[model samples]
Target: MLLDKSVNHDEVLLRTLAGRNFYASIQTVVKQKSDGQLLLYGIIEDISERKHAEQVINELNETLMKRAQELESVNKELEAFSYSVSHDLRAPLRALDGFSRILLDEYQDRLDDKAKDRLSRIRKAAQTMSGLIDDLLQLSRITRVELTVKPVNLSQLATDIIVELQKEASEHQVSCIIQDNVTALGDAKLLRIVLVNLLGNAWKFTRNTDQAVIEFGVRSSETESTTIYYVRDNGAGFDMAYADKLFKAFQRLHSANEFPGTGIGLATVYRIILKHSGRIWAQSEIGQGACFYFTLGK
Candidate 1:
């Protein structure tokens, strides 16, 4: 029973009975009034189950946090290993490619036409291999490198990239357009690589088109966060049937004879987007055109 206001319970202590036969708590106090009197109140509750549940919850949370840390450590090791392999292998491979060319250049008269042709093919293959290795290294860096996101002027970025791409080769009259003043916070350099690859492909695929058109700009989706920037090109588009395989490493939509590439550019681009915690996808028809959609920022 709860005692009246005359009793004091704040000074109570949880304890057992004097005989140690049952669980209970009590307090003794003296009240001041016209007549001084002593009073006592007792109260108690069983907290064993609540204490056990709290301990269990703490243990489970600790285990989950440890597992998450372990997984993060594993991913770091894997990324480091990948970067090392790509960077280390490229040096000697370049030597092989260069020496082979030197052999052909100095000893052409000592060899037959077929031998010379085979040597040329070897050089081409080695160059392509070197390009593949370089792309892989870039991909690893994109994954492991720390991102310094800052407000970037998309207007200037696109203009500079398009100018450089035009200078890379002058054979094609590529039509370039920047449709919007897209701005966002992200790693400027990585975004440039993404743009270069996308624009390069647009320029490559539209070789057959007399008026090869490639446009870059901002795009909005229904949701605010879903807003993205994209590149669209009028090129020899691929079959929609194999769309899923387009971004996988070493996956190619066209024959090497028809188009020359290591088949890793799109894959690298995909990885960069993923590292930014963004999405990348493509839309294409057999011969119509292709549109590459990618998230540029948060």
Candidate 2:
């Protein structure tokens, strides 16, 4: 075919007579000389390795796409199951809590001391179980909600949350330091949840300190355009050995007697940050207090 053409460039995958594959790029040029004789030039370069690499990449891409689809399907099923479980338990919890409260209010005068105490215990247990149910639902919702990303004034958010916390616990005299103009790009709602959990933990752990101090700020990274935000507190810090369990669902570093919680807040925060393509970590010493650091990807 090249012998009949004046000038041509083509790439061909050829099977040699020896029965092996070879990819070759061919360039040909032909011109009529002054004496009516033809001049022919041809160049052929082997491109087998490049073609093989492209084939391998295409195969890898197909496999990755299939895996991604499967993961998405599995995640949807898990979310549905969580929703069902939480919904089923909520009705019973509400009934128990409502009945216990009613019995205590209407029958306290007729009931004995032991009976009243038993009713009180039932009420408290019902309330705690209700809280756990709510936390499970919240975790599931956060995991499944679509994120709405925008510029958020993180410092202002922290200040708002701190003010609310102070109002709720007016007896506690704590000093809070929030850096001005600290900001980031993320889902404002989800970021608020993260701050609420982190700041709430700081506040809870600091209850034993006479004059608790909490700080919220951002530090510039040396080699990246991203900022690292942190919440620090002078409080009852936990052992570093248990740090790995901090973000798992229903894992608590501190006992409920010391810090009353459903052990789901950190797990929720972790999911929110992960949805934002971010990272979160903590540093602490038993008595010196703790600092939590996080980054929202730019």
Candidate 3:
């Protein structure tokens, strides 16, 4: 160049004679010599590695976005299926229940003892199926609901649930020990469901025991910032071998006759804990009591 000026070009891509790509920073300067001739200077620096890294990052981000979209589509489809099945089955379930009840009531004289028993069993199965459907809808709805997190007095909530449980089954004589000032930051309604399921399971399991003692408290952890809350009971605890199946949908460790349940409660609890970005686990042995521990948030 024949100018007395300086210019800079940053991170310019250059190609070699062999067709390989490289990145470089270029600068140019012009100077006038005493002989009235102009001199030009240029400097170049390679930045090929940084350019290649940026390209890889861009590609990774694009792939992640596509995968996220695909997952969202799958979730929407599953939610739609859950909702449709729940809504559609309710009508037929009600019809079955109603018809069976009517037959038992109206045809009592015409039907024999075995026929009446069969009708009763049919009605019970229908009711159980209806309960299962309701639980499924609840599990599906929990994901869609907006979470309103605030400082919730979990101690009070536990006491209230115990009160309701006692009122429902006043026949059970069990003692409950709830720790005072036990609070957590979470959605009140969702957290209440968690407690209801856990505490209810405790009460149910302790039914066969001579003395039932249920407790709710927080576990202090020296290494963790979050407090671990737990529900403990002296009842018919489950075997640790089947612990892995505890939180799966419709997985029951006990027979329906021994313990009447839909098996969706723990699965719902698992989903709720996951939504809050927390963890849950249980410790138990056969004939020993079970203790369920969980964290709400990070």
lDDT scores for all predictions?
0.79, 0.90, 0.92
What would the TM-scores of all predictions be?
Answer: 0.75, 0.76, 0.85
On TM-score, the stronger of 1 and 3 is 3
Query: Which portions of model 2 show Cα errors greater than 4 Å?
Result: 1-73, 220-225
lDDT of each residue in 1-298, candidate 1, tens digit only? 3334443333332445553332223344433454544354334444545556878999999999999999899888877787687768777777877888898989988988998888888788888888877787787777778888888776678788888878877877988888766876778888888888898898889988878888888776676666678889988998989999999988998998998998888888888788778998899997787999888545
RMSD of 2: 4.3
For residue 188, what is the lDDT in candidate 2? 97
Q: Of 1 and 3, which scores higher on lDDT?
A: 3
Query: Which residue pairs come into collision in candidate 1?
Result: none
lDDT of 2 by residue, 1-298 (tens): 4334654448898787899989988787876678877778888778899888999999999999999999999998988788788768778878887898899899989989898889888888989988888888889899788999899999999999999999999988789999999988999999999999999999999999988999999866788677889999999998999999999999999889888999999999999999989999999999889999998874
Model 1 worst lDDT run, 10 consecutive residues: 19-28
After TM-score superposition, what is the CA distance of residue 102 in candidate 3 from its true location, in Å? 2.1
- Give candidate 1's whole-model lDDT: 0.79
